[model samples]
Target: MSAPRRPVLAGNWKMNHGPSDTARFFADFLNRLAPADDRSVVFFPPAISFAAAREALQGRPDVRLGVQNVHWEASGAFTGELSVAMAKDAGAELVLVGHSERRHVFGETSDETAKKVRAVLDGGLVPVLCVGETLDERNAGRAEAVVAEQLAPVLSIIRPDEVAELVVAYEPVWAIGTGVTATPGDAASMHHAVRERLAQAFGREAADAVPVLYGGSVKPDNAAELMSQPGVDGVLVGGASLDPGGFAAICGAAG
Candidate 1:
């Protein structure tokens, strides 16, 4: 039988924390995060703070680092954007693709996101592809449809063999950073839908092995319950992750 899916606790700093703050955050985070062999933990700090986060993560190789975003092109006048190679050089082992802000705030299209996913994979980095629906979409009963649409382009490009390294995060736009969260039941249902979509793209065995995380206002109080739900392989934390102690508490809960 295939091995069980490993839990992944990832933090998306999202324009918050600089080099100094990153160093201090890791200093405290590492202390509170107990060593574990059953799960994986990753941090996607702002690009500017990559070095500081890397330096701080010296002894803990188990804790991986990632870029919040990447450009599809290897090099160009895409001014103000970092290429996949640059991100890899910056010590990123993974890359976040199609984050809510990038989709809504920055007008990123699924086609573009597809290219970024391909780029990240080609550059030998893992891609944490974030897919979710907006508040209106959910209210209109189109949440699952919206998420499937977003996943289509990216999923079509991923080979069955790559499913194990691909991390899909379901972060409903309405709940993110809005002090709102989906109930465990609601989150689990969505996660189940995501897995079904994965199964359609890759086979059941490969899909079941993919880590599907929930990431809408996830906090310490509700983390364990969310992680305990079937099909919720892990979480992608936002605001709550900014706090060293709080994030550590959430990580501990994942175990």
Candidate 2:
């Protein structure tokens, strides 16, 4: 059977641009896109630039806009945080949660990530949840277990049917921005393992429907081989995504 067909090419801008830069990136990238006939392309800009990116994508049916992050609460005194409602209002159809930087640098735990995931769905937006293992964990032979732990909390809250609306990104901590990438076979292996874990946690149908993306040092050069993997439905591009031509190249490869 052909691999499940939910391929999403998402740009995780991380902490890259301001509102002006966001607008430029969108204009340049969206304008150059030939027409997304085979895959869905989503751009996750910094929270502050969501409105700008939205405006940039105005009337552009081929491109979609998403947010880099969202808070679990609808509204509260959480200073310096963007809430789910705010993200929706800013025109985000999807929100990224549990990225490695957030987990490692910002001290966000899986429980918090789960809350954010629930919030995104409740707010009528899809959550591109990220889950992966560190090099130490992989070296210690706990890769699957670590990923399972990261997924357990979210699974406890969301139903199996809800999996179709969600996208998962597996980005090994050590590989991200380190000029290191998981070999195509290794990436395929982990992706398969992730799908199996999802099948066990939810059900076979949900697992098969859910799209698992491989992220971490993804560039245009290796995009095709990575996308050819059995369970790698898409990519969560980072550094390469900051450049319009580079990101567009990767998306074109997905086709």
Candidate 3:
């Protein structure tokens, strides 16, 4: 028999929630759901609320806390930047790098993202690396090339054995928050391609073991179909995750 796939459901609470709001959400969320022992569930909040999230999740073995972004430095005078050490101090077990918004809005280059990945891993935090293609690139038949390019620099920094410690989310730029989800077939195709690239870069065993999640408009209703795909390991939920019950349902589907 095949081993059961480990499911990861991460909530990217991008730019939402203050300290008080963070506390309230966790209070309600923890109270409502059973502990997620069979799967891994993460909450990725903005840099400002990392402490609040840490405080709330302390001693709670059920959930893992994550950070939306982290600078590729141990410590520095870089103004308004949160370093990997700072994120670790705040209790983040995972750090998100190369998110679509970070790439499109903040202009984070792949080289910088690679540095951040190394920083996070060196600091003992897992990195959730985001890679995908823009609508323009997809229309121009460059979707695969675009994603491959994004993965190239990061692959150079980490070994195949290290890939399992990192999570990759394939979120199409056009689908994020636009309420348009990629068909399961489309998502599976890209996920398979990503696995192929990993195999070429790191070899077969490492490629098959790495978990690649599908993000962009993922909700309870569509989660099962996406999960049914061979290469899809889990989901990176956005708006649906704001509600504890809704997110719980998505996790249950993964289960």
lDDT top scorer: 1
Q: Which digits, one per residue and each the tens of the lDDT, describe model 1 over residues 1-255?
A: 134888899999999999999999998889888677788899999989999999999989889999999999999889889999999888899999999999999999999999999999999999999999998999999999999999999998988777887889999999999989998998999999999998888878898888899999999999999999998988999999999989989988975
Query: Where does candidate 2 have its weakest 10-residue lDDT segment?
Result: 1-10
TM-score of each: 0.97, 0.95, 0.95
Q: Which rank order by TM-score, best down to worst? A: 1, 2, 3
**Clashes (candidate 3):** 0
Residue 37's C-alpha lDDT in candidate 2? 55
lDDT of 2 by residue, 59-126 (tens): 87667888887889889898989988888777778889999999999999999999999998888888
Taking every candidate in turn, the Cα RMSD to the unseen true structure, in Å, is: 1.4, 2.0, 2.1
lDDT against the true structure, per candidate, is 0.92, 0.87, 0.87
